[model samples]
Target: MRVVVDGMGGDNSPQAIVEGCVLAQKEYGVEIIITGPKEKIEAELAKHEYNKNAITIVDAREVISTNEAPVKALKTKKDSSLVKALDLVKNGEADAVVSAGSTGAFLAGCTLIVKRIKGISRPALAPVMPGKNGPFMIIDAGANADCKPQYLTQFAQMGKVYFENVLGVNNPTVGLVNIGEEEEKGNDLTKAAYQLLKEEDINFIGNIEPRDIPKGKVNVLVCDGFVGNTVLKMYEGVAETILSEIKTEIMGSFVTKIGGVLLTPVFKRFKKHYDYKEYGGAAFLGVNGICIKAHGSSDARALKNAIKVSKVYYDTGVLEKMKSAFAEEKDTLKIDE
Candidate 1:
């Protein structure tokens, strides 16, 4: 499959992005089109040995910075790496678009340019995160701050499709994130969402508390972007703080240092569980075409994994499956004209 990557969009820019594309091309056997300034992208590519035929460069002169207004940037930066890369997917020239750019801009470009799938009110950002049992997905992660109960139901549906198809989870269980585990514990939104989700065809597991998220009680956690984003950030912060404290304590004294050396393998494995690079990026589900929002600070390894994630999304025919599933719900999703 062919994947278009925004080579100039990340913190590491063309270097990490170019190297990652090369790694993905070599390891995954996928054709990559890197969009950025030709000279800068090529300079990075020349540093590594890669199959020239498998990787192509598309010139995009502009870049949308993180601080810029997403909607305005998307409209004006037509030649930006992010916009051009997305255009490839919109035009069917590429199977997916991956960007380690401004998250807001990426989401805006996907909605305004690539467009959302039919019957989908707003596309949700679903990020696969490490949980106790394994990886779980959180939908609407910083995508839509305010949402209707029906929107949460749609998120649950889309999240289920992705978990099963992309993550290889069978009959994934869905849960609405709430303050308490009881069905009637949450506010109007969660309570209403619980009712909707339970009646759907998915494996609804009722309410899931934020405290139980790390336990991996459900395969898909659904919430409004406001709550989901808060959960995601808090999780990251806690993990980082714990790891940092552990390391500091491990080096506190010679005795602890010796113990630390002996426990290095265990610590390494534990740290891997929280590494964002392991999951690559979050998928902009409900978009008409595949769009992966890689972490802005993504390194080569993370970028490579993000491209790999895109390949898996494309190969699984996820967009087709989502389209069909949403088609069946179109009648229920519509409001009176």
Candidate 2:
């Protein structure tokens, strides 16, 4: 698989991003295409020994900052690393795009440059989050801030495909994020979406309350971007705060410190389940091309893992499946894309 890396994006741009491309090129053997200022990318590449044939460089002088408006950035920063990397996918120069740049800019570029699936209403930001039992997905995580009932229903379908192909889940159970498990709960939006979800040919598990998310109640959790974003941030925050508190209590004194030493291995194993680096990045589903949004502060390890995700996406042919899924329904389904 040929994957493009935005070498100028992320907090550790060019350095961590470039190092990550080398690691993935060596381990996964995916052709690495790095986009950024050529000299800067070259300097970073010099730090590591790699097969020159496996790695390619594309020079992009402009950069879009995290604070810039997403749409405007994509338009103005035409030659940005983010834009150049995405262009490679659009032009079939690469199979997938992996970037840790501005989320807003990245999403905008994917939707505009790479384009959405033929009939897809909106592409969802689906990330495989480490759950209590195992990893699960929350679709439309932050892609579309506002959505209709039908949009949420489509999210479930796309998410189901991902669970089966990528996560190896068969007939994955799905649920709508709501205030109550009962169908007659939540605002008008959830209530309407609940009914639409039932009509789709999926393993719909009814409404799933926010409290049930961390427990891994369902494999594919569906919600609009606003709610999904809140759930994701809250889950991450609570887990991090709890781990921090545990560390503080573990170091109360010499007696507790000895106990902490004994439990260090256990803690490491437990923490691994919640580490964001393990998952790498979130896939922007429904796009015509493969676009992954790596964490803004991704390290070399995280970057390598993100490339692994791109490989899984390519190897599994998940994008092709998604295309076929909506392609057949275009005639019967009145999708107003």
Candidate 3:
């Protein structure tokens, strides 16, 4: 499989991105096309020893910043690394596109340039997070801050297909994030969404309280972007804080220091569970082509893993499966509307 990467889009820029692409090419045996200013990209690439035939470069003169307006940047910056990389997927020159760039720009570019699958109202951002059971995914993890009831239903359906196909979960349990497990809990949106989710042909598991998320009670957690984003950030913050506190205590004294050394492996394993790099990036579900939104601060390892994740998405044929499912549900969807 071939993946088009934005080599100039992240905080680490060409260096981290290039190294990551090289690692992915070497380890995964996938062809990579890195898009950016030719000189900058090549400079970092030359530092590493990799299979020359497996890596290619495409020149893009512009770079989009996080502060720039997403829609405007995408429309005006035709030669930008972000836009050019996306074009590769739109034109079928690549199976997937990976970017550690502006999240807003990535979402806009995919929705406008690559487009969304038929019958999908809005594409959702679904990212897998470490759960006690393994890993669970949160759909609309900051895609649409505001959504209709139907949108949540769609997120549930899309999240279900993704978890099942990509993560190998069978009939993944779907849950609506709310204040309580009761059917009548939540604002008008969640309450309305609860009813819709119940009617859909899915493994609806009812509501999921935010407190229960870490327990991995459900495989797919569906909510509007606002709530999902809040949950994701809070979870990350809590995990980081806990780890930090643990490290501080472990090094406080000679005895503790010895204990730290003895338990280093255990701590490493625990940290790995919450590390964002482990999962690579979040998928922009419902997009016509594969588009993965890597973390903006992604390092070389994270970028490599993101590419691997993209390959799995491509190989699983999740896009085609979503298209078929949505197409078949189009008629029934209208009735429910």
Q: Which candidate has the top score in lDDT?
A: 3
Which ranges in model 1 have alpha carbons more than 4 Å from their true place?
A: 334-337
Which portions of model 2 show Cα errors greater than 4 Å? Answer: none
A best-first ranking of the candidates according to their lDDT comes to 3, 1, 2
Clash numbers, per candidate: 0, 0, 0
Please give, for residues 112-169, the per-residue lDDT of candidate 1 as tens digits.
9999898899899999999988889999999999888988988999999999999898
Worst lDDT run of 10 residues, candidate 3, spans: 328-337
- For each candidate in turn, the TM-score is 0.98, 0.98, 0.98
| Global local distance difference test of model 1 | 0.92
Please provide, for model 3 over 1-337, each residue's C-alpha lDDT reduced to its tens digit, 9 standing for 90 to 100. 9999999888888899999999999898999999999998888989999888999999999999999999999999999999999999999999999999999999999999999888888899999999998799999999899999999999999999999999998999999999998999999999999999999999999999999999987999999999999999999899999999999998899999999999999999999889998889999999999999998999999999999989999999999999999999887774222
Give the range of the ten consecutive residues with the poorest summed lDDT in model 1: 328-337
Error of model 1, residue 245, in angstroms = 0.9
Cα error, residue 31 of model 3, in Å, equals: 0.6
Model 3 TM-score, all chains together:
0.98
